[model samples]
Target: MPHDDFQLPEQPRPYVQPPLPPKRHGTGWWIYGFFAAWICLGALISNGWSINFMVITIVVTFVGTPLLGAALFAATKSDRR
Candidate 1:
């Protein structure tokens, strides 16, 4: 191609990168929460809802599950290219 060609532009457009996909950590926790709720309900009922056990169950299931989920999700990130 000749430099004097009319079809050629004096400057080319700069390259731009596409944005990354949104993190899925929130959705994953929702799924885990649903299942954990069912399992916790079953266990609590099986134990006849003792006050001490209920307290422990609520804390571990609601608090621990999300913390563990976040750590796992963060550690194993996916690339949605």
Candidate 2:
């Protein structure tokens, strides 16, 4: 029999950390967007900075650039299989 003042301590469970979440990945589509915006700027310059065309050019630069980038990203993407 063990004395009341002398008892062994219980063993502690080992520390087990949970797994981390997966990282978000991306393809370099904005690189194409920069190229597209540059091309739009060139077009605006060649058109003598017309106001109406300037508006259209800007719309295309912002709106179309993203669309074009997404299209390229989708087209060239390969399956992980």
Candidate 3:
């Protein structure tokens, strides 16, 4: 196409995403939170006396819960593209 021939089409426009969904409080959230805490507590009881057990449980609680929540959100989100 030549520059002289180029023109912008007059069309409604392409859609743009407004934004990521706002953080929501849903039953799913509570469930995940409870499950994470429960696992954390079990870990504490089962291995609280062991240095390795305590470290592993702390790591899982800190890193695992959010990763699980994000995965849940990603799975449930609508595809906009």
Error (Å) of candidate 2 at residue 34 is 6.7
Model 1, residue 47: distance off in Å is 2.0
Collision pairs in model 2: none
Q: Tens-digit lDDT track for model 2 on 6-72?
A: 5544544344222211211335646656766666675766676667666766676778777877786
* Residue-by-residue lDDT tens digits, candidate 1, 1-81: 575785566556354223333455445666566656756675766676667667766776777777776776666555332
Q: Residue 67 in model 2: shift from native, Å?
A: 0.8
Q: lDDT by residue for model 3 over 1-81, one digit each (tens)?
A: 665455545434544434434333342675567566867686767765577766666677667767876776666564433
Model 3 TM-score? 0.42
Q: lDDT of each structure?
A: 0.61, 0.57, 0.61
What C-alpha lDDT does candidate 1 achieve relative to the native structure? 0.61
- What does the lDDT come to for candidate 2? 0.57
Worst 10 residues of 3 by lDDT: 18-27
Candidate 3 regions exceeding 4 Å error are 1-23, 31-48, 79-81
Better of 1 and 2 by lDDT: 1
The TM-scores of all predictions, comma-separated, are 0.42, 0.41, 0.42
lDDT at 38, model 3: 60
lDDT at 54, model 3: 68
